[model samples]
Target: MSQPEHDAYAASPRTLEVEDLHVSVGDHLVAVSGVSFQLRRGEAVGLVGESGSGKTLTCRAVLGLLPETGEVDRGSIVLGESDDRVDLIAAGRTVWDRVRGSRIGAVFQDPGSYLNPGITVGRQLVEQLRVRGGLGRTEARERAVGLFTEVGLHDPAGVFQLYPHQLSGGMLQRVLIAIAISCEPELLIADEATTALDVVIQAEILELVARLRRDHELSLLLVTHDLAVVAETCDRILVMYGGEIVESGPTEQVLTDPRHPYTRALLAVATIGDWTRRTLDVIPGQPPSAGEEMPGCRFAPRCRYATQACVSAPVVTTEIGPGRSARCVRLDELDTEPGAVLVQDRIEATA
Candidate 1:
């Protein structure tokens, strides 16, 4: 197979910054706590973690698309460049309307859930064009057809007239991508956009996304659990566990030299081949429940190298390398291969 083509975007001063964000459902259950990250202009940052690790919540908080019951209690989500930076947490509906679909578009995990069954694809795309681009009906219709063609749809007019139900999963995903890039957003958030599709279709969607990012000069936040998927698409990786970022760095650096036990465990299972040729290496214990107060390291319960300090002391963000950080109390004592502890645990279990 040929290598994927890359497209570079023009340099810009804009960036998306999330600082000390805390999101909660109702009053008690905090879904995302003290999570902070930054995406520079035209950068693809992959947010990876198991489900319930607060990946989707962080994306929703940035877009101000959190459910009615969910609220941002602490921290600010700042967008745009230095002089014109706007805090999304304080932005009103009018501001969000102007920002979303225009400056910041999102492609959700499921197209069927977001796309209306009764509406024609053309009508939906035209609505976005009219609202975001302030175009007339004829102009919007023309733009919609162009978008359909751009996203690789065969018959623009035919696909435009069809309802959501009329298209296949891959087709619907392509339509969603078309809609997302309709207004040419500076930042595109794809939350598990290819999870539901088969392997072949997922590759196609990812390739399309790569092309779109280059052509449009868009910064992408790809939320996914598969480390391998992001390895192929993202520049940096942010590993989250128990609603907190446990480690983050350049994609290759983090994937090849993981410092946190949680990150190592996640990478161990995200493999195409298992050397053991037996049971796959799995992380023991479940994630803590939402709003559950963790006194020390959130992953200590399942960590083999965990000790008294890990169970009672605060897990400080240790600087493992330049621009790389890991939240683990025993970072200095950790071995190069963190998963070796898993092997030791199994041997002890069977002994």
Candidate 2:
């Protein structure tokens, strides 16, 4: 059999490299189109977008949890040591089973869902360690307890014995963190893991994650709708829209000087600058339905400066140098809006 065309990207030291990933929800609905990015060990990669912009779905793909109908129609995700990069997209369940939850740990949107209400936290963590590390029961328990203490959970012994319903959201999330890193996994994926918690708790979790990454030398893939979170935590950011990455750069650069309309729109609406503000700039137009076919650019309907040229021209990655890139037809001419504006209509959907 011949090698897939995109395999040339396999040997980089990057812990994770997702290239032109296309995932379809079903026969017709494409959830992610041409998404690509890489994560080096000890670095953080953030994916930011509005609800339904495919941020969460992209992370799900990394964990091999695509909807039953969902198919990774194209792309490659290479993870592992040099010269031995494992292809995440083409790999079957057995391959994913070994790599996921072990080599690539994840913490999802709700820690509540992560814990089984009937099981004690210790059981969950110990079981996870045993499964992933192939440790004996005693060894797994010891490591699980050690992990609890490592995350700064006081009275780790007592907390380990409690069930999911017994601990506060923050505590449970911390336990999930313990499970995620117990194997000393090379990568950690956090998908809006703190969304359900309060701000103070969210900051704690974020800080804990950052600290753990630093202490363990782990790569991080952070997926969230919160740009503020990206600004505070991630080194590099990837902005997605209608499935594809529309812009990417150093987190600071993208936040302060976004070049794409979509990225600008995202920053414009951020309430981050004013906590007392009552309203946010709401972008108009619903995201195209999964796999909904379209003839032109996916973001065209909501873009302010779109023209006939944009209607037919495929959005391509335009380099902004220093690792920054934007997908736009008029990158230089875009009117930078520091704040979000409400766009109300599709007006003309075609050129």
Candidate 3:
């Protein structure tokens, strides 16, 4: 079948909408707060940030797979279009059972941990297809093999009988991808899915995902700390910091001309695209721990441009351009031009 046009899918309704989400680990400790974004049909959005930025927590909330102590303290996660919109927070286990794996699928960083070592990878996939897909045993097996082949696994039938430990890391990842998309879900969440792979394998896996998205019209939520991965795969980028989004815009615009100081700092450290070999820069200080109760801008302490006003009051997200917004108290005073925030000199001095 011919692949659908990108523009055709762009006009479709949103697949997921998260509004002012707040996730708390316990009575205190709000791990994720005031997070909001929308994923249009067939669109791929990357949520990028350093560790402890709540990227995984935000994705977990969307998937309704938060830890035992984690709970949605406030906010609504609406899934599906207007006609069939469902608030995931209000939806009980029964609703979740019906939604997860069928409408929404997820792939995590470690594929091995999710699969059973005792069972053949193919059998596990077949079981999922039989249970969630409602396929007969024979049909499920056939579908499993087909999915394996579709994901670029060589000798699908032969590989099906092998245990999880029998396959290489790249192959295991492909198996995980096959299982994730076996049900043909509308939304696919890949949380640092390629972090464990080498560069060549990572590129291959990313290409596979992009092709699948194009062919199946699947909306993707990619979570990762790697800016280069996001640059290559995502249409838009959401830069997270201290449990909140600090900057968001088109991928090209955000990469080339970040608005927030935090975003610029990240670019300084990231190795994106082809460039001459040079010492990489690093942001100073540690990111705030989850629910650390930052009264003002969370990034103010590490931001060189932060002023009294930045630390005196909470920062609000301000629109700087079309489809672009940033949360920074000194957005007007700072220079956000490409390569304007030169951290190389500081790095050299420290070195």
Highest-scoring model, TM-score? 3
| Best-to-worst lDDT order | 3, 1, 2
lDDT of the candidates, in the order given: 0.84, 0.82, 0.88
What does the lDDT come to for candidate 2? 0.82
What TM-score does model 1 achieve against the real structure? 0.90
Q: Give the TM-scores of the predictions, in the order they appear.
A: 0.90, 0.91, 0.92
Clashing pairs in 3: none
- Residue 301 lDDT, candidate 1, scale 0-100: 82
lDDT: which is higher, 2 or 3? 3
Clash pairs (backbone) in predicted model 2: 29-290, 29-291, 30-291, 268-340
Clashes of each: 0, 4, 0
Candidate 3 lDDT by residue in tens digits, 6-120: 3444456989999999998876698888998889988899999989999999999888899998988999998998778999888867887788888898998999999999999
Off by over 4 Å in 1: 1-14, 272-281, 338-351
Which tens-of-lDDT digit does each residue in 89-163 have in candidate 1?
A: 787677877798988989987897899898998899999899888999999999999999999999989998999
Error in Å for residue 85 of model 3? 1.7
Q: What residue pairs clash in candidate 1, if any at all?
A: none
For model 2, residues 1-351, the per-residue Cα lDDT tens digits are 013412432233688888888888766588899888888768898999878889888888888888778778888888876676889767778889898888989998788886789989999999888878899999888888899999878899999899898889899889999999998899999998888999999999999999999899999999999877887899889998888899998776777667888887776677554555577568887767777776667888898878887878676788776577898888888765544332111111211
**Candidate order (TM-score):** 3, 2, 1
